[model samples]
Target: MKVTAWNDGKKTYGIRVGIRNRDRFFNKSWRNIEVDIEGSIYQFKLTPGFWKHCPEFRDSVKPTIREWLEKYNLVGWPKRKPPRFELVQIDNNKFRLEKYKISL
Candidate 1:
């Protein structure tokens, strides 16, 4: 699945969830999600309302994810088109978030 970066016009930054896929990775009740990036596991939440389908990284773990993205130059600024990445479900309630690179 493709994940995009987003900012709330403030210090906060997160992944944006677009149309929901037919193959569901998350449950309908919308519980907290855990994603493993590289080796660290970050906690994310399903924001209320229309965004409930996408999981937003919680503040407690926001800086870490942001730093990792920045370190690899994989992030896009708020005004420009946000960077996109690949999200893979490795197991139940478990997923791996990865940066995608295209080859010529």
Candidate 2:
């Protein structure tokens, strides 16, 4: 599964906090997660909460994007035939529970 993010030029763009196993209680594995930005700054994931679902990342260490995505459990989303807006407007977007799509 893959997600497409747009560069909004507003506050940071396209970054998302990975939703963990939502059904479970607190998880410590978040501490090991990483983020990578262009400048080589790194970030780590946090315990279960809004931080885990951040539309813009709020971590301390920044790892490579590849590493960040590797730890994330991706939810599949359909590609928009023609994006309606210059930037993706929503924070986390929406999940189609009745269907099998995660819209970003």
Candidate 3:
């Protein structure tokens, strides 16, 4: 699975995941996965299908997305105020959380 991210110019960004078979002919279309980055926090919503395609990312997706945002300077760091981190579960399997620290 290959993950790619892009901004939508509406204070929101999108992540696309692509998978290809070894034969190089069986390629699945990109899957639009919901993701957002605020300061040092990265939030991602992974569905059961998404997890099935890229389960390896389950534990490292947050940091990986954060790194991508930071590499492109997409996230901002505020020195005067720090944002609070919270984890809210949308359901039994869906939730959002904030992680990582943004440097000043």
What's the candidate order when arranged by decreasing lDDT? 1, 3, 2
- Taken over the whole model, the C-alpha lDDT of each candidate is 0.63, 0.31, 0.37
User: TM-score for every candidate vs. truth?
Assistant: 0.73, 0.26, 0.25
Candidate 3 at 22: error in angstroms?
Answer: 16
Residue 28 error for model 1, in Å? 2.1
* Backbone clash count for every predicted candidate, in the order shown: 0, 7, 0
Error of 3 at 64 (Å): 9.9
- Give the lDDT of residue 12 in candidate 2: 28
What value of lDDT does candidate 1 attain over all alpha carbons?
0.63
Q: Estimate, for each residue in 1-104, the C-alpha lDDT of model 1 and write its tens digit.
A: 77676666656676655556313566656556778989888877655633445344434444766676678775556466777778888877677888876111
- For candidate 3, what is the lDDT? 0.37
Model 3 agreement with the true structure over 36-76: per-residue lDDT tens digits: 33433343444345435542123234355445556656454
Question: Mind sharing the TM-score for model 2?
Answer: 0.26
Least well predicted 10-residue stretch by lDDT in candidate 1: 49-58
Better of 1 and 2 by TM-score: 1
